[model samples]
Target: MGVEWVKKSFLVILMMLLAFTMSACGNTSKAVQKTEDGKVIVDFWYALGGNLGEAVTQMVDEFNASQDKVHVNAVYQGSYEESLTQLRQLAGTSNAPAVVQVFEVGTKYMIESGYIEPMQTFIDKDKFDLSQLEENILSYYKVDGKLYSMPFNTSNAIMVYNKDMFKQAGLDPENPPRTFSEVSAAAKKIRSHFGTNVHGFSVVTHGWFTEQMIANQGGLYVDNNNGRSGEPTATSINGEEGQRWFKWLHEMKQDGTLGDYGRAWDDHRAAFLGETVAMYLDSTASLAGTVTNAEFEVGTAFLPTADGMDPQGVIVGGASIWMMTDIPKETQNAAWEFIKFTAKPEVQAKWAANTGYFPITKAAYDQDVLKDRYNEYPQFLTAVQQLQNTSVTPATQGALIGVFPEAREKVVNAVESIHGGADPIEAINKAAEEINAELENYKRVNQK
Candidate 1:
């Protein structure tokens, strides 16, 4: 609870907008910058708050402390949406930072912006080995099959359970729930034994939770050609599998087991830590923060599934470092240096250790320090194991279309319908229709 803990440097940043259709910032698309003071002042916009901001700053401080030529000043911009808005105001303005942290969902926008440098060329010229990063992690930043952003700390959802609750329910905590059937069974047992004192399971479906469920069911949330492939003019989200996931949520809600809508990952954790929710599934990054303060012994498991299907690949989460194209070459180069430096193994392993995000570099995962982490906290290994075993399935990778935030909100509005007595299938079908219409509109407006 110390101030340092508040700023501890490597926390996963979540900018939950509740509703996705916020007015986006006016395009900061291509501007130029001039240099001053012989010290290139590289503007760095970070989305992390508290100690996580401190962690990013810790590295920024190191970069600054290491040399006098480039002065990287770190700016904390509230959340991803807020940072994008700030960038909008600073766009074409001299105050714009050279580097801004962008969430994965914004990848398509940044690539189309043409305002940032492509990372592939940067690596080839700088002799930065792109091969050092695992194939699974590297796919998150690519556009048109070329790298644009450097993969930083990455994570995926992991199943979390209250061990005491599981134990009271006569469930084996060590084994945990591997598939959806087991999850249903476990929930029933917990409810049967602990009554309403404990929960069988709960998942806050905002942000990428819906997509994660799609991936969990071995289904794709969006097609490769964006939403175009799923249907000529619709989405495939209300398919049998997607409905199954929603049905599970609906059942949980009806059984007095599920939690609320609009409860973000952090809010759910706050609830989980408060002992209100017995089981939760969320980002791997949640472990370190929650474990540090958890009063009960928490258990971790691979995200569950149904019947014969394996746990589908998990989608990548966590922010990436974005370079503004308008910044002076010196500042841009300096920003690249910092990005490349952070991608190094030592720093990555340290980041992984500090935050639950899996290291982007294999070296970090193989590092002695990180290897010891698994030994120290077996529960922490779930995501690491899951991500290692994972693949870049279209479902897990996510959809790429403009007005992404808007589309995500439409999905939520469908989710909200379930509480209002609407059928899950009907609600999802309505959501896909809305998404397809918006998708076409976005494509039309942002046409190249």
Candidate 2:
């Protein structure tokens, strides 16, 4: 009887132990997802929405179908700011994505965050030929002589005008404004011809336009070579170039030729489409949509500079793909494979054609897809020419400050104030002072 009881107890104990072991193994497998064939799974978190999001998902599907080694799981995480905020909370945890798309203004913050692996590391390991990419676009992502991220969707500010309206106003349709004074004059003429029913010009009261305007005139947004050389101690937006920009808008407002569309991009674009505004400043990314939706003929031109100054060119405004550091090396490699796939000429061509962003890869221009797109929408070529003509300088390479997003808000506030009859100099000076204080605080916290 005692022997039978001992045997029953031993069997029960052994079954419980086996059950626990099996459960542990199942939990470990759940930590990192994999395909049935044991391919590495990479998590890609992107911030693009609407058609752009669909495009990203399509690319991921194509990549998955093309390869058997890696599977990419694309996740949309909201807007640029929201995505970054989520990353801040999830970083250094297993819940973090292997790759993320960060905007241009987030460059300094991402570099200092210590949460990402420099793209140069992978480039060196794989002997990647960066020369195949566009040099001007690449310059924006290179910092401290190293490439921090891979440029994906790139764009520059351009002037989109109503060619029909220009003719009606007795202005040269072929000769759009090339200087601030020219734009002001043209705006007045446009308003005069159309009367109070339409405004001559409008730009969304966003700081990005202000940045591009300042940079186009060879002006620095901050000291220390726009923070490329070292940390920026102060903002230079109150300088001569910035003052010219603010003053230009002020004069137009006084003349009642400028449309106040607030800060919403949609509102400004709607105004242009609705024929409430004759000309407007917008990103190249809007070219395709605006051209497709507009009833009147659309003309694209380079952003205007000050009266006598030659245009230095506009800064690239878009996002780049970043690889995270906390993930396993295998997953990181998988992320790299996806990144390389995104840069392929065929893939980039498709992306560019579907969206208005410039393909970072130079070879994409040679692809039939992109060529067809350019042929279909000739206005798209203006953005390409503008970027190619841009002089690679400290100003044009764009500013690098950890507080860039915040600083942009300050600039927008200054613009609103100036339009509301505030003194341009005083409004600009106030913004600069606020940005300087923020920069000092950022430096203090980030100091090693």
Name the candidate that leads on lDDT: 2
lDDT of 1 by residue, 160-273 (tens): 888877777798978887876678878888778877866677777574778777877778655554432332244567777778877777776677666663546688787789
Candidate RMSDs in order:
12.0, 7.5
The residue ranges of model 2 lying beyond 4 angstroms of the native Cα positions read: 1-32
Tell me, by TM-score, which candidate is best: 2
Badly placed stretches (over 4 Å) of model 1 are 1-37, 225-233
Question: In candidate 2, what are the lDDT values of residues 48-142, reduced to their tens digit?
Answer: 99888898999999999999999999999999999999999988767889999999999999999988999999999999999999989999999
Error of 1 at 340 (Å): 0.8
